[model samples]
Target chain A: MAEYPDRLKDTLADFNFVTTRSERAELLIDIAGRFEPVPARIATRPYAEEYRVPACESDAYVWSERQPDGTLKFHFAVENPQGLSAQAMAVILDETLSGAPLEQVATVSPDIVLRIFGSEISMGKGQGLMEMVRTVQRHARSTLAEQAS
Target chain B: MPDRSSETLDLAQRGYAHPDVLVSTQWVADHLNDPDVRIIESNEDPLLYASGHLPGAVEVDWAHDLNNPLRRDYLDQREFEQLMSRLGATPQTTLVFYGDKNNWWATYAFWVFQLFGHDRARIMDGGRNKWHAEGRPLTREVPQYKPTRYKALPRDDRHIRAFRDQVYQHVQVNLPLVDVRSPEEYRGERLHMPDYPNEGALRGGHIPGAVNVPWSRAVNPDGSFKSASELRRIYESEQKLSPDDEIITYCRIGERSSHTWFVLKYLLGYDRVRNYDGSWTEWGNLVNVPIER
Candidate 1:
């Protein structure tokens, strides 16, 4: 009997790999797991970042604002684009939210998911990383507007 | 009484409308007239600094200011203090730094400023190219500056520094070394420092068992860095880096390494990272040190 399935599962489980492998294996796993199989892994956006110019370059990316919950918001920029990774960016936000208890910061999200304050912001093809950034920005803007009102 | 207290602006407190990584040329141009603000042109090339630089800016050579000639890494405290005093920096003075070569030296200076406990320091975005392109003022003549009592207390313990000996220890332990150099240089295709001695230097290649990350890979086309989440993915996912392990970053000279160093320390929040300032210049020059093509 071929142990290929077991080998593929083991390979897919290793989080330490720099480049994620086992795409074919993942597809197989997805097919087996779902009742109805669908092409879900396909990426909609060719380029990971959508904007021709990053929002950080423009004046629109203002630093100081008040969240709807009446907390301070601050921005930090890096000279090199690579320095500000999604996970690293989350760490900064986590640090900034220190003024409020981690619990309070999470009250905006589900109690279970919000319990972890420093969760990584996703940034992949289609509505992955970009979608996450939009959610964070939307919440931030709404909070600021509410505070102002 | 004129209120000098309120006049003491905390640049950090305002949160730099730009973000933590970049400071705009417009902001720098607007504040050029502020008497308290001093700009320093930190360039690896003497000719570039000599030909043109921001008006009223002092020139600091990257090879000299940020490294030790004898040891090939971060400068000793005594030399660092002397350099700060020479730059007319006081404990109270706010220093704005930039460079000719894509803000490499400027980033190194930024690291030095933070290492020496100067919180009011920033790097000019897009550096000299942006400043000059936007028609900001520049002067060829070196402006004379009166020496000031610039108190420097190097936070050595807090800073991420590794001597030659420390790096050797890591190698012995099979630790990962990230070389932020061009692929050519890492693959033994590039050679020689721009202006430094070449007598004893090796022909080409990078440190043994090192990974080439290329410092330029970190920036976008306009020279601005990628977003925080983006940067984190690149380093963590692509580079396969763990937050717990020690990371040693190096380049041809120390300038690019320092830029990466700033990213690893302040941006990625890596606790155990260090810039091998001696980098290829000193490492390649050494007789018996291991090299990999």
Candidate 2:
């Protein structure tokens, strides 16, 4: 089992825009808590083999391990793993609140999408959805940068 | 205090998707057989269709779909109308577009549809990458076409475009041409569309009257769009984009511009948005066109 890192724990703690650390921990545990030990499958079409994107020598990334309750949890080494963009975090909150599938959330609508951590969240379709998460991280970093400046 | 607070409370128009935007690969697959739904693969790569694509998807190459070699970036309404005619698209067709890297071209095409006054368009979330990853069926065989009699809606010329002539006509006018490309591309450090390389590229700089708001800044890492309200707050409050200001977006070859175009026109309800389709590719190549950095 991969151990959760200390920095991630602290960052998760510091995200008081959503809730306190214990509350965040409780949310993570609740969402991913019910897992049974399932075999882990690391399935990815090698970009070099399929798509021809140049391979990096040291391309390290997060991986998920199946828990005893059959759910998958991700772990990160460089930064916070459970640290989602406010939008992504919102999708989870919406799914939890409305009992709708994650697939049902729309990323560009004016509807009152459920808020997680005081951020209204929505989902975009396809790989472009990553743009939404990046937007949040950029906002956070820009906010930090602005404050520093 | 009342005036400022009233301004805060007032929203120009709450723009959004009719049925909300995100749709899973499974949901798309389930509706793959719908007669009213047409799946378009808007890829930069030519072989996207040859390799394999959604069973009934018609191929749309961004380079080919938008322009000929003569005018690569911009598509005049007549040209755009003809392209729509060839695709058998009517004003009423509910275009469900998907692209290889999520929905870059799909979103671009969605913007094109809106420019042409077709509102019934949606992007397939996760795109073909997610669809194929989920063990969904793909076929290399091109589906036989039963061409429908689709007619073009008259171009809403006011909403569709802004030509160099128009910009030149208003050269002294202080309109903001917002370049949504990366800082490198906007500064002319990067060539437009590395695939179709061109020489005589702008040495290094941007439009004097332009602002750099990289499109990638508006997205999440998981390939979804940010919420509209947050997006509004970011672009409006943070970036200080006035609601009434006229904004034009451009990129290397106009693909990325369409992403911002979607955000501005459809997402934020900025109705005065115009895409400078010629972008750098056209503007940079013209011998007499003014060059900036």
Candidate 3:
């Protein structure tokens, strides 16, 4: 059993309405369109190794912060803006999990991506998506660990 | 990288069976304003064209244009005609294709065009990488053109395409089969290309009696095909394959094999070369299929 964020649940609900490959592709492309670079002030910093998503091939960077309200905030950036699948995954995860509680962020099982993309996504990209989730979760876990310390 | 673009290979002098099938980046740059020429950037990464492409070029999503909207095969004649008309291409229009990964997808698009009997289509040698490596200009602005009235030739799957049945018969007869994938993939060591993620095929290795001649062997590190004589030596002399032998090339998803198919049919003037589009993705998943480690 897993607990998901409210927004994530709604997003999944919205995606569930997509029953065809075109619909899923349209959803992904729409979400990918929303991914853009973070502000230069933050982008210029030495992107910490812990913030980087390993083996993404597009060089994605992520960071998470624990707000005073005990919710998580995520910042993400990637080198290849035209990487639709990878960028879409980043945007989708950030949208679903940012401002979400640590527990909700941790609840994003790998299968959610499979449910949304189905078999339409290629195996390489599927691996890339899992790697992305792990990277974001790594950041979220660090944020929790830092707050606890 | 050569600083002077003139040092680039003189493609017209290559003496290929279809020499006009290739055009240099300089030629593409020179023809930017030509009304008769249409530049179409076809890439494996569907979104790559959005980053930047050659000036006045339009992007074609191969899966969107080439695939049958409702079925598992490529678009029918009517759909292809509609697509051509929508893209402002007429029967007489000359289409030049270029993209990332050398010209893997470019050649694939060319193969699809050939399948539909569009003989005027051409490949931009070295593709986007070569064009960009030489510091040619890339524009973010996608051009808009008036759509034209176009009619496509009836789709012909024969002569160029090989189906599972044909491949099985070829294997039974022990006809030449070129496994145009990475060495690891050919040897059953990897399910897919070393860099490509595995797609969960139940079996590993290649079709029995297939010879390993990695597609990259036909191409240079910079993503350009080698000279015609060199290519002939590699395929005919080195591999001990004859130009007249009936040949079939296959890869995981058929894109890389299409490239080898291009080199054999057009570059080396091999008359009986065909691309098994289903390739390993279909062969590896089937039950009771003969696979050699």
Per-candidate local distance difference test: 0.56, 0.53, 0.79
The C-alpha TM-scores of every prediction are 0.56, 0.57, 0.76
Model 3: per-residue Cα lDDT over A22-58, one tens digit each: 5676677778889866667566656767667765656
- List, residue by residue over B1-293, the lDDT tens digit for candidate 2: 22232112212222343224445566678887777777788754333455567888887655556555574344667777667666666666677888754466777777766666767777775566657666888886676556556566655646756666765554458776778877876767766323223422444456557778888666544444555665776678777786577877777656678878777766667767788776766666666755565
iRMSD values, candidates in order = 22.5, 17.8, 4.9
Candidate 2 structure lDDT: 0.53
Best by DockQ: 3
Model no. 2, DockQ = 0.02
Q: Tens-digit lDDT track for model 2 on A1-149?
A: 22223333343344544554234434534433332211235434231232111111112123333345433333221111212222233333223322221122112221221222222111122112233323323333443354458
Model 3: residues with Cα > 4 Å off, grouped in runs: A5-107, A110-127, A134-149, B1-8, B12-17, B140-142, B192-200, B229-238
Q: 2 or 3: which has the higher TM-score?
A: 3
**First chain TM-score, candidate 2:** 0.23
Expressed as tens digits, the lDDT of each residue in B235-286 for candidate 3 is 8887888988999999987888999999999888899999998889889988
Binned by DockQ into CAPRI classes (incorrect, acceptable, medium, high), candidate 3 is incorrect
Candidate 1: where is the Cα deviation over 4 Å? A1-149, B1-18, B63-79, B154-158, B193-200, B285-291
The iRMS of model 2 comes to 17.8
Task: List, residue by residue over A48-136, the lDDT tens digit for candidate 1.
Answer: 34222133321112132344556544332223222222223333333434234223333332211111211211111111223233434
The prediction achieving the highest TM-score against the true structure is 3
